[model samples]
Target: MGRQLATALLRASSLEPRHINISTRRPETLGGLFLDQRWVSAVLYSLLNMCTAQKLGAGKTLRLLNGLFETNTFTYHSLVNSPSASDLNSPDDLFPWMSLVDAQTKDTPLTDLVLRDKGLRDCFSVMYYNVFSNLAEG
Candidate 1:
C-alpha cells in the first residue's frame, strides 16, 4: 500500500526514489513517533507562522514547502547512503527557508521535520482541512 502511494506520488510530482522512506514493518509501538493531537495543532500554528513570516499566502507556502521537502529529502538520502560518494549541497540557493531550518535543527533532517514533526503521516485529515480552507478563502 505504501509503495503504491509512493509510486503514485513519484509519478505525479518531481519526487525521486530518495525522496521517499518506506518501512515494511508496522510496529505496534510507535512510542514518540506517533502523531499526537498537540502536534496537529502545532503543525497548523507553525504553517500559519511560516506563511506570515515568508510573506507568502498559505497556498504558496505549502507549495514552497513541498518543493523544499523534495530537495531536502534527496539531499539527506544521499548524505546518509553515500556521504563520500554524494556531492549533494544544501538547497540554500533555491530554498533559503528550508536551508535555515535544516541548519538550525542540527541533527533533525528536513524530511523528518515535514514527515514526523509536521504530522504528515497521520494528520492527513488535518492537512486536507487546511488545504480546503485555504482554497475556500482564496
Candidate 2:
C-alpha cells in the first residue's frame, strides 16, 4: 500500500519533483513508484497500508487534495483504463477530469493542480519516488 501511494504520487507530472517527500527506508523503497511516463495513476484505497489509511479522514483527505490541486474541486480519472467514449459523452453533472487536456468540453478534464495526479498520492509519496528513482537510475 505504501508503494501504491508512492506510485500514485510520482505520477503527478505537473508537480515539481522537489515538492514531494516520502520515506526512503522500507521493504519496497520508492523505486516501485515510477514516473517519467504518460500513464495515469491508479491507486487502490484498499491497497493502502492500514496505518496510513487510518491516519486519514474523508473530509480531511478531500481538503488536503484540494490544497494540492489548488481548487475546491479536484477530480481525477485514469486515462489508461478510462470509460468508453459513449460513457464519457453521456450527459452527466459529474464530469470526469483528465490531466492533459484543457478544452471547454461538456465534461471538464482533470488537468488542474491537485487532480493532475492520476493516483492522487500526497506530496510525500511523490518526493520519495523522485529521490529514489534518481538514486536507482544514477
Candidate 3:
C-alpha cells in the first residue's frame, strides 16, 4: 500500500520518492518501519475514514486519497475550501501531528527530528514544505 501510494505520488509529480520520508530499519532503504509497523486504530480509523465513502464533506477525503493514488496533484485548495484541524496520530504511526496533503501546517518536532535524520533529510518533497512548513511561524 505504501509503495503504491508513493509510486502514485511520484507519478503524479506531487512528490518524488526521494522527497517523501518513509523511514528505515536498514540503511539506504527508502521504506521500512512505515509499512512494517502497526498503526494505532485511531489513526488507521481516520485514514480509513478518508478512504471510505463519507465522513469528510462532499467525499473530499476520499477524493484526496484517490488523488494521492492516481492524479496529477492532490488539489488541496480546490477540493477542500477549508481543511479541518488535523488530529495527531499516535506515536506508533510516526509524525502524528503532520498533516496529510491539506494546506495546513502544524508543529511536529518529533516528526521533524525523524525527518531530519542523516539518511532521511532532503527526502520530503517541496510540496510538503509548501503545505507543512517547518519554520516556527509556518
Candidate 4:
C-alpha cells in the first residue's frame, strides 16, 4: 500500500527523482519502492530519525509542496526553460502522467517489491522532485 501510493505519486508528478524521499527506521531498511528507473532516488525512512521534518518543516508538508510547485519551481515551463529545457506542454508531458495513473488504477504493484536491509515499512513515504526519463525526452 505504501509503495503503491509512492509510485502513483511519482508517475502523477512526472517521475521527478528529487521529489521522492524514502526514509525507514534505519538507513539499512530502504528496500523495495523502485518503480521508475536508475535516476530515481530511494530514501530510507526511520522512526528514530526525523529528518523529514527538517526538510519539510513544522506541520506544513502538503502546504509546502503546494506552494513550492505552485511557484513554478518545477512546472512544465520551468523544465522547458532550463538549459536542458524541453516542452512541458507537449504530448510527452502528459504521457507518463497518464500511464502512471493507469497503472495505479489498474492495481499494478511496483516491480520487485522486497524488504531487505531492514528498512521498516510505515516509517515514512514521500514524493518529491521528478527526474524525467528518456521516454519523456522527445
lDDT of 1: 0.38
My TM-score estimates for the predictions, one after another, are: 0.26, 0.26, 0.22, 0.19
lDDT of 3 by residue, 20-118 (tens): 543323333534223111121122223433443233432355355445434332222222223322321221222122234321233233233333343
**C-alpha lDDT score of every prediction, in listed order:** 0.38, 0.38, 0.32, 0.28
Worst 10 residues of 1 by lDDT: 91-100
| lDDT of candidate 3 at residue 50, scale 0 to 100 | 40
Per-residue accuracy of model 2 over 33-97 as CA lDDT, tens digit each:
54322222222222112213445433454444456434455322322124532344422322223
As for candidate 3, its clashing pairs are 19-123, 19-124, 19-125
* Clash counts for the predictions, in order: 0, 7, 3, 20
Once fitted onto the true fold, the runs of candidate 3 whose alpha carbons sit more than 4 angstroms away are 1-31, 40-44, 48-55, 71-138
Flag regions of model 1 displaced more than 4 Å. 1-32, 68-119, 122-138
How do the residues 67-104 of candidate 1 rate in per-residue lDDT, one tens digit apiece?
A: 53333322333222244224334332121223323333
RMSD to the true structure for each prediction, in A, is: 14.1, 12.3, 15.0, 16.6
